[model samples]
Target: MKKRIVIFGSFGKVGEAIDRDLKINTNYEIIAPSKYTEEKSKYWSRNNCDYDILNFKEIKKILINLKPNIIINCAAFTNVDLCEEQKAECWKLNTDFVEMLARATAVTNSHLIQFSTDYIFDGLGGPYSEQASPNPINFYGKSKLAAENAIKSIDCKFSIIRTNFLFGYSRIGKKTFVDYVLDNLSQSKPIKVVDSLYSNPILTSDIAKGVRKVIKEAYLGVINFAGNDYVSRYDIAREIAKLQNLDTNLIEKIGINDVEFLANRPIKAGLKNQKALLDLNLKFQNLENSLLEYLTQLKISKESIKEISKNKN
Candidate 1:
């Protein structure tokens, strides 16, 4: 019998990747909270899921009925600065919601796969291991860390996948870090990127693959899944510019103290992916290769939109 996997936030970049992949595999059944309407599914990509994830009672009802074997939570309020301004909202979604999931999953004996961020650490030093201490500097990180703690405190079976600077193909409402750089550089618009902060930005598709591997192997504990290259955001922007043949001159470098952010940034929260590499036997593609694939996806997605428009006409 195939194992049932319910993906919360199935339309999200991470969720989309995982859903697309798992649908192809025979061993797992994929159920997203939202499914496309008959008309909309024809044009848009990933038009799925309706249940309000904010309502834990509703979530409880669903979990009790579905009793899925694996639950991948791709939902969260990830806006760093917005999280600072909206602390209560962040806590409700990030911490409170997750706490509910942990307890529910524990009762159901379902494995919960939760995505976390590198913001959990103080920027003093990194390329950090899984064992490194986490001292969250901002509200977003604090909320996520609280969620992590809640999961650990429960009797639930879980795998907390911690990563940073996630980049991937575009979704309708959500934009990846790569999207921000490509949009500005292509338009010759000036973009200010911080040079002080460093990270091994992982691709969402890769993270999805790691999630699959984790479920397959039943690996437990915190895994730091991220890109192989540890580099600054400014450099990553330049890499995108050079690859896309965009105007590198449009990119400007700034330090951490230069900007006025409501939330404090962890300057060097780069994670070491050796464990993921060894444990999952996964090779995170080099920067240029990943960017090239991203470009290919961009072209394909653009053409898909055009085709949808043409069909309508």
Candidate 2:
């Protein structure tokens, strides 16, 4: 019999990519949970994978019943501002749920795969390594860091993957960095992006594939999985415009503090993929190439029209 894997937040971007990739390439049975209503069920369901509505308590019951050998957690509270406002809830989902999952995984003798973020670092420097000390400037980062610690504190075998600036398809909201910038540019609206903030914009599919590779190789411990290239928010916008044949002049660069934000942001969020590359022997595409592929997949020909059509369809 093939091994069974239980994926949390399987309806989200990375989750969907993982579900699709595994279903097509592996013999492992993938089970996911939906938190939507009946009329909204099709919104969450994709590619005929087994799915059911579940809460945290219900999730535990499902895990016990299924007895999966591997558990990949793609669920997270990623809204930076909301995390600051709902610190307790963020802790509940980001930190507490991880602890619960770790304990359950330990009980079942299952391997755990948890997603983390580069926001754990304060972005003091460029291209941070796995060994860099994390000093998060916001509640969201703190919650994820706490969760990472919780997973490490447990006695179960696990892989903590730290990534940033993710873009991909989802059953949920559709505002990505590329979409936001491209949309603003196409409308001839002057856009201001932080020149200080920097990180690799990782494709959701790449992250899913990296996680799968880690599982297949039976790798353990913390790993930094991200794009091979480092880029600033302003640079990303400029590149998106360039790729889609939009006017790059519309993407005006501004200081980090210039943009009003509810939560504090790190100055540089890029991660070194050497560890992941060495361990998994994985090669990540550069930012330009990755953006091109993403644009092509969405069937975007021009910058201005891409966001509207992509979101609407």
Candidate 3:
């Protein structure tokens, strides 16, 4: 019998990619999205999900019914400024909901894999290894760190994947760094690209591959998985433009502090991929190669749109 896998936040880029990978690999039975729809679920889960993650009772009940051997949680309030302003919601989802999952997983003995971020660090010095001490400067980072702490405290088997700069082409209409660059440049809009903050952003599909390996290996621990290249945010945009042949003139170079933000950001906050490489044996796609793949997807997307339009006419 195949091990049953349940994925939450299946609509997001990471979740969608994982879902597709699992289906393609045919290693596990995947269940995506909570069964409850808007009318059937509660206020919070109304259109979002079927069950409230904070409610241990509901979480427990759901786990008992599903009986999944693996649970991959991709849900989170990721907007830094928004998380700072909405502290209550951020803590509830990022930290509290994860706590409930960790506790519930203890009962079912389900292996939980949770996605995390580089924001857990203060960006003092990086290309940080897995053992680096965490000192989050903002509420979002604090909440994510709290979630990691909660999972660690629990007895359940879990792997909190700490990744950075997630990039990918999405059929689900999720926005990415490439999207931001293309959309702005197409409209002839000038955009500010931060030069100070740096990270080794992993491709979403590559992250999905890493996830598959983790499940196959049954690894239970926190791991830092990201790209091989370490570059600044501004350079990321600059690279995107060069790959897509977009106008480089419109891209502006600015420091981290130049842009006003509600929450503090980490400069030089890139994750070291040595652990993932050694353990998972996953060699990540280089920045240029990954960005180039996005170009191919863009061509297909354009052709698909035109075909649909022609059919309608």
Candidate 4:
């Protein structure tokens, strides 16, 4: 008699991490669907539970049929510059779909856990706390902020987690800032790193744990789940190069003005995690430690792949 959990964007970095974490920590039945894969049906129960999130009819039907206790939404159009150009698609996924989920959750009495971004702030005075007011500078941020409000306006029970600068290993090679730096440096490709903008980079596993705590406590309202260090993008690049023993000199520091983006980005969008620190009683990993652990995991994964290839040969 476990409480069933339905996870959207199940193949994305955060969604996949949460799905993996729950499999180990909780006995709850988990349903994770790939957006365009029929192969996922072999992994999940209920034949109708597919990953087609944009299909409102299918989503509603799933909610009504499953009546899950929790729905963790990690699905979002996260490309900042792309979001500026695709305003309609951005709102449809980030805002409109969230409203639909909020309403459906209300019907099922399911607690909704929605992931968000730190870009909601103007980056004028940060790192911001849970109490800080939101003034989004980009369309992506605006759409997410709207989604947050949509959930809040509904009578449904919900938790919004605002995090920044997420870095992790994606099986599908979906790259983060860490990946971009590592890939470029490993190939001896000269990389231009942003020096002015600052953010706290959190591990995907850490964010999943924080979300688990939120689900356990059924915490309502917004909370910040981010890393401990507030460092520049260039600082992160240097750290990665140092850990991998790569040539740090290949990394060039540049300001925000150097990069041409379709959307306006926040300069200091780091989040303050004091609330999560006290409420969840969870200790967060600093940037250096998190990166070290992630790289170690990556090494192990690579070794495992090599071993499998050797055995086959």
Candidate 5:
């Protein structure tokens, strides 16, 4: 009998990447829920995997019915600014939903894998380790930290993965840093990026690969997973411009405090990946290399021509 795995938020960035890997490489029977109807469920279905519409009650019901061995919770309210304004909704989705998942998985004696963010730390310090205490400066981070604590309090086996600056493909929308830069450059618009804030911008595919490695090795505890390279938003934007042969000078670098954001942001939220590398035996690409690979995968060819055309117009 093969192990059964259920992944929440199957259409999300990291979730989709994990689903793709599970479909192509593994023998585990993967099941995921989507918001779409059965007829329109092609977005979530692939390689004989199961798909269904899921809610809190539905999730609990499914756990009772399927009795999966592992439940990966990828669902969360990740919008930082919006989460600040919508406190109730953010708590409901980010914190409450995770608790519900933990309870359901625990009843089935299943292991839970929950994704968290680097924002759980206030960014006042340098690189954060798994053992570092979290002081969330914003509502989004607070909610995520609450969820992490809830999962930890549960009796079941669980792994809480804290990562930063994620970029990846999904069925819903393109909201990644790489996509944002490419979209702005495609319109020949000057980009303003924060120079002070730094992070390990982990690629979506890399995160998926890391999750698989953790599950395969049965590693337990909080893991700080992120890209090996530490870079700022401005550096990332400049690199994107260089890759597209656009004028790197067009990217205006500004301090984090100068920007008027709706929610507070961390100044240095990069996580050290030494533990992930040593324990999981995983190697991560730098931010520049990851951006280049993302662009190539998206077939953003004729890059110089596209920018020139946009500028000329």
Candidate 6:
């Protein structure tokens, strides 16, 4: 019998990447649920049971029904600025919902895999290891930290994977660093990027592959899943320009203050993937290789769109 895997936020970047991998690469049975029905499988807690993540009773009911062997949580209130304004709402999904999942999964004997962010660390010191202490500078990070602590407090089998500055081709309506740069640069537009903040911008597909390894091994602990390259936003933009044959001068370097973000961001929040590499035997890609791969995906996406248009005509 194949193991049953439940992926929350099945339509999001990480969730969709994991879903694609599971369908193509792995033999596990996946129960991917999203807000809107993307397929015939009726797994959305709201549509099926009229209950969202905050409603513990409904969440428990859904988990009990599925009885999944592994539950990968990719859903969260990820808007950093909005998280600061909507503290209660953010905590409900980031912290409260995770606690609820911990309890429900505990009851069902399921291993829970939760995703976290690099914002949990203060920018003073960074490219942090798995053992580094988290000093979140903003409410978004605080809520995520709260969720991590909640999971730690419980006795349930859980794996916490912390990453930072993810970049790649996201699903429709989702914009990432790569998308932001590519869209503007492709249109011969000038792009201003922050140079102060640094991060290991991991590809979504790479992290998804690493997660598959973790799931297979059933690793129980914190793992810093990120890219090998530590770089600034400006450097990444420049690399993307180079890869796409765009003018490097089109990218302007700026400080973090120039962006005027509502929430405070960590300046040096890159995570070290030594632990993940050593334990899971995963080798993270550098910025150049990762961007090249992303470019190839973009080309494929464009070709597919053209093919669809041709078919329609």
lDDT of 3 at 240: 81
RMSD (CA, angstroms), candidate 2: 4.1
Q: Residues 1-313, candidate 3: write the lDDT tens digits.
A: 8899988776677887887788886668777655454433331233424555556677668787888999999988888999988999899889988888898788899999998899999999987899999999999999999999999999999999999888776664789876888899878899998887889977888889899999999988989888888998888888888877889999999877788999999887989998888998989877888777767767888899899899999
Clashing residue pairs in candidate 3 are: none
Tell me the lDDT of model 1 at 13: 79
What range of 10 consecutive residues in model 4 has the weakest lDDT sum?
A: 40-49
Residues 123-174, candidate 2: write the lDDT tens digits: 8885788999999999999999999999888899898888888786554445
Q: What local distance difference test score does each model get?
A: 0.85, 0.81, 0.84, 0.88, 0.83, 0.86
- Best candidate, lDDT: 4
lDDT of 1 by residue, 158-237 (tens): 99999888777745546877888888778888999888788887777888888889999988889998888888889899
Question: What C-alpha lDDT, on a 0 to 100 scale, does residue 292 get in candidate 1?
Answer: 83
Q: Which sections of candidate 5 miss by over 4 Å?
A: 37-42, 45-54, 300-313
| Per-residue lDDT of candidate 6, residues 138-204 (tens digit) | 9999999999999999889999999888866654647897898988998999988888789998888
Q: Per-candidate RMSD vs. true structure?
A: 2.5, 4.1, 3.5, 2.0, 5.2, 2.6
Report the candidate with higher TM-score, 1 versus 5: 1
In candidate 6, the residue pairs with backbone N, CA or C atoms under 3 Å apart (3 or more residues apart, or in different chains) clash, namely: none
Model 2 CA lDDT for position 181: 84
Could you give me the TM-score of model 5 versus the true structure?
0.89
Off by over 4 Å in 1: 34-49, 311-313
Residue-pair clashes per candidate:
5, 0, 0, 0, 0, 0
Q: Per-residue lDDT of 47-105 in model 5, one digit per residue for the tens?
A: 43443333578768778788888888888888899998999999998998899888987
Best by TM-score: 4
Q: Which prediction has more favorable lDDT, 1 or 5?
A: 1
Q: What ranges in model 3 sit over 4 Å off?
A: 34-56, 305-313
Predict model 4's lDDT versus the native: 0.88
